[model samples]
Target: MSRDATSSLAAQIDARLSAPGAMDAARFASFLGGQQRLGLTHGGRALCRHLRPYLIAEHDYAAVARAAERIAAALERVARRALVDAALAEELGLSADERALAALDPGEGPFLTVGRLDMLVTEGGFSFIEYNADSPAGITDQLLIEETLMALPHLAPLRRGRGVRAPAPHRALLCALREGYAAWGGREARPTIAIVDWKTAATSAEFNVLADLFSAEGHRALILDPDELELDGGRLSAGGERIDLVYRRVITQELVGRRGLDHPLVRAYRDRAAYVANSFRTKPLNKKAAFAVLSAPEFADLFSPEQRAAIAEHIPWTRRVRSGRTSWRGRDVDLLELIGAEQESFVLKPNDDYGGKGVLLGWQTPPDAWRAAVRDAEAQRAIVQERSRARTARMPTFRDGGVAEEEVYFDLCPFVFAGRMEGAMVRLSASAVSNVSAGGGVTGLLIVDDPRLKREDNRHV
Candidate 1:
């Protein structure tokens, strides 16, 4: 496409947002509600069933694919290193008992079984922040929302680019779940899938999405909050049904403690319930410290010289910040001074929190606030990471009384099922945090095939 054509397409989108007598947020909300109702009434549990699927922008796909390739290679290197370490630990008469326990699937292990990619894509390219190796949410939710969004009439014209196509996340998810079931000693009489999460509104919403997807796949899906489950004679029972496959969405650390060794849910999970997604092993990988394993001197041979150099350039420098522990003593001794010096370049993150909570972006807050946050971080098991500037794009949004401009960016979350990459969930957010709870809108991921748009040359706008 020519520059003029691209500009024209962008203008069309802008015009839609700035149309004469533009719709207000209240009207937009009403329209959205009506669409949701229509989906529920016509599609029978599917949201936004009236809209058609939109294709992923071809230029965006090239950028995403390139970034994914690099990240996948790095993950492969890291996984290989872990496997070698596990083998060596076993050979050297270390962790023998642990290995035996792992063989038994004792619900406690050091190795991770699944991984997730949280990334951002801009006109420049894609930047991956970290891998959610434990329990990444939004796979099923993304598909649900994507399917719903594509059915809306308002979004139909938005799919004008060459070979626009939304990736089928539902089909991809079903395949992954079935693969996990088959891997756990083949199919059974009836596959009983359990979606596990904490008993909270947010977690409940996630469970609802997964349950709906599982139902569509002809499986007996049970949504169970950990607190509601009971272990009766080594069987997991929730809502009067036994669980065979567990789609674990709860934090591994929290689940282990809540459903102790004796609970039926934990016992079933440990003994026979095939964890469809991430299992207990994901805990270590979810740790910020896991990235340290990538930079460790002991794992130097994991990557080729070129790949290693690329990794160093691409991955952010992450250091574990513990109370009273001087990570870099002689190099930088001025904690207070440095905290104020590079306020805009650092991010303080808690080790185990999600949905963008407990994240303090130094550049977004006041200097005094940044100092206070840094001091608190120093008091906790938090890590200070180098912040990469994520470029944002403008999206049309309806505010309370008028059409307003909203900052948006592409969140390309690739789902890795059973250690293999499958598909992605694209989330567009107005704020820096692209979480659904943050009121971000979602769209379908479409991959175009046009040769002109398929090339990497169009990455820059």
Candidate 2:
């Protein structure tokens, strides 16, 4: 859609939200209960219960499809780079244990594992910050919410468009997951799937979604707190049930810190007693250093000519920023000078943090804060990277009995199941931190139909 059309749509959305009084907590609770009866979990299901019908009308299918294709291609490229990086890490002695861990079979053990992706999309293109490669949420959430939205009384106009509606993302996700399992082994004897994460994590609803999807697919699914895990005789168990696969949602680093190597969960994972998504091997991809690696001249032989060109085109040129004294042009320079020189164009990031935490967008922060952050970066192995302006769209949200404007950025998470890129989960946020836990909202990505695109154009004319 054109800017005007998008603006108009935003207005419509705002008007709709303001048309009704703030939904009472009781009404919200009832809506949530209704969704639970339908087996939906996560904020996704709740949001879908309220917003799906509106979205059906709000989305333009053809534009979405075009966007999806572009985003998918970019993701595939990123995946290929990750595969190459994994190989390089192995050569560098950085990922030996991870390789061993990934080699374990799902059916051979009693533990479960999960995978995640941190993604962002824009009009310029989609770029993935990292693959959660360990534990990603919202699979179940995406489905339940979509289901609820489709059932809303307000969505008839959307339902009638484009002839046939798109399939539920949850169903698609289930199919992809089962296919991933089958590709690894089979479902002849159902694998005991568990959605594993912290009990108090804000996104626990994601676990519920995954559990429901697994159950619907005929797999015995359970949601377990990572703290409750146990290991015995080379098997992993949660709440006393043998776990066959773990849809891991916990940060491995956090897990490692809390349990040490002796924790039952760690022991089972290390012992290869269960299948883990993305494996521990996905660590390298999660490192901001990995972005630097993508730009290195030494790795030129590793990428295809096309892949090399694409990487060069899409990624910001990045480098490891180090501390200490160095001589340039026979003059000694300290860390402060180096940081000051590139403050406007660079972002300083800690190697292992996410959700935009501890990130110093040099231009956005106070000069003193930037200097302190840079000093900290020097102590840790923080990286300095060129900043790319993320594209934004204007969205209308209801607030204080009136329509309000917000700037939102899009994130496309293309789930890679068993090394193949499957479908996507799109997130939009008003803040730089697009994390759902940080108050970002999820939206249905519609691939615009050709007819609709033409209609949109005609309307514009």
Candidate 3:
């Protein structure tokens, strides 16, 4: 699609949204009510209030999918390498216990069963900022959000004539889990699965939805906390029911923090008596420093030509926060001095964090605070990445008794299952750090099949 087509489509969408009764408060309220009844929410809060799904051109989505596949393959290779190379493992910021756990053989099956590559679709194309390889969220809810949108009477044209269709990531997730289970030597016709997470976590509702999905597919499923799991003589069970597979949602760090490295599930995993999606081996690539590893020229030889090209195109310059020298653009420089001198060009992020916690945008922070954050990141072994542009869209937002079009920051995250892109999750926010847990909103992503309808302002989505 050309830039003219994208601008025309944007105008058409804006005109449609501006039409009388198109996005009236009453209809918006009904949409919210539908979401509530369907449990499309996070921690009892409505997950999205946007009037329409984020639109992506089919061509743009294809490009993103290709880039994501290459990056995923590269990360997998690096993770496998880190298991044997102690120096690489240390560079990835793996602790002693973490290295041991990650080194444990996860039996047969890909190291990553499911992953979500968080990326920004900007005017210059998309760049992946983070790889949520361990346990990606927004799987089941993406479908539900799309269903709610499609049901809106005002969006009937969008539903029928616009060639707008939602991506089915939930189906991909199920397929990945089943394949992983079979590859792990499971023979059951319908594996008994457990979605493991703390009941107190805000994402616990999503676990219930996933369990229902498993049950509907003729598989017995249970939602279990890490504490509820028990291993008896190589058998793993939750609430006395044997589990054939564990869909681990509990972050490995939190699991280890609460139950220690010798937790029952960990023990079973080490003995190869359990099947876990995105096994402990994901720790290497899940870290923020993984981007540093991928973008740095020192590790360029580890990737193939195709992967190296993708990394150069889609990955921003990143390095682990340290006081030593590092290469930048073919030249060596003192890492700390460069960070402090060029404050506005970087972002400091915690090594392993979610929901936008402990992230300092150099352009936004005061000089003193920026220096403090730099020091803190170095001490914590965090990462500093070159700031990448996050795409913005004019979305219909609810105002006093009406709707208004407001520009908001948004990111499109592709859900990768077993190295293939199935669908994407779109998150919107007023802040630069877009996260649902940080009071941002989520919307369904629709692939626009019509060539006449495309993106706006050269942005891919």
Candidate 4:
């Protein structure tokens, strides 16, 4: 980045931090403790861990908007390409697991109707790190986290001075749910929407908040487990009411594992007895192999010029676990050899797990351990991605009864609905991983006096 640009960013951040309420760590912790009443706590602790917040400028927000468009396009291309030519999709490659998922009927919806794009901040804009269309868990929570932090008196100046506001993803999500009901031909003025997931899932709290939000919006919303549902005579009913729309939040594959895909919900969706926001088709793109399809040269022609450019610019070097010759930096290289040679520059992750499970950081592991992770990845159909340099910055965190300036690493995740960019989640951490589930913090969104930023982006919400 140019010196002026860097300094400009620093100035914006400083403006937010210069306030009195900027760094009360103890108060932040207490604030989190009070979130249980709001259903924002997880396992008895606040879901948002970072005390320091993100202060994004208007230009940075616009850049994220463009990045989201390109990402949505890329995901669409992959899903359509795979559908048009199953044989060609095979060439893009996958593990037996991902292949099976790809074969499943995704039903009639965008493969990734509602999901998130995890990215790293960069001078150019944002680096696409991972596409998470399958099971996006934290859209509402992210917004809530930001709002919770903004309520602090010390940070009140940032809101009053900069016109700070974070977009509510739950509102956009409701629109998508309503759209799904309409697609299912439901004529109810306000369809009964059920947030379907495992009864014991950690996100149950957010489900309650959503249910309340839906009630306020003129819809009867219910949070229930799949097992509690019954498909009697083709009508999927839950809690004694005929469900018109199902805002499915369960991991289809995992749910399928427990009860085959032919389960009532799956069958109901296929038969048009009900509607699912992210249809069954999203399971395919949920796999890590989709990244391989996005970055692999063999599949480059499948995407449009814009998509190809997005892949090249934002996506890092990535490949399926299988051994093969592939292009890297515009040239072909032996995949296994390169991975084995440069252990620190890579990471191995399970194609379908969440919450940082089965992820091995090469730089943090010993040589032997990295080799094991590489071999295991090949054995289980995993993905190897080049490590991204997620930027770090110093923030005032309350520690020991006073604000302590500490440096933290963070990542940006843009929430997309039907391939359209809506809002983003910011996860800050002291370590490399910035997932809230992995001890990261979420900060509020600030617009610096752009009231239109709220109204214009909020048309659908």
Best by TM-score: 3
Q: Global lDDT for candidate 3?
A: 0.84
Candidate 2, which segments miss by more than 4 Å at Cα? 1-123, 148-154, 163-169, 183-187, 323-339, 451-461
In Å, residue 130's CA in model 4 sits off its true spot by: 1.3
- Candidate 4: residue 343 lDDT (0-100): 89
Candidate 3: give the clashing pairs. none
lDDT tens string, model 4, 340-371?
A: 99888888988777877778888988999888
Candidate 4 has a TM-score of 0.88
TM-score of each: 0.76, 0.73, 0.94, 0.88
Q: Write the per-residue lDDT of candidate 2 for residues 344-366, one digit (tens) a residue.
A: 76688777676666677777878
Candidate 3 runs further than 4 Å off: 1-13, 329-331, 451-461
Flag clash pairs in model 4.
21-154, 25-398, 50-441, 106-281
Q: CA shift at 135, candidate 1, in angstroms?
A: 2.7
The alpha-carbon RMSD values of the candidates against the true structure, listed in the order shown, are 6.1, 6.3, 2.5, 4.3
Overall lDDT per candidate, in order of appearance: 0.56, 0.55, 0.84, 0.70
lDDT of 4 at 189: 83
Tens digit of lDDT per residue, candidate 1, span 24-77?
A: 555566556744543322122222211222234556555454555555566655
Q: Is candidate 2 or candidate 4 better by lDDT?
A: 4
Query: How would the candidate models be sorted by lDDT, starting from the highest?
Result: 3, 4, 1, 2
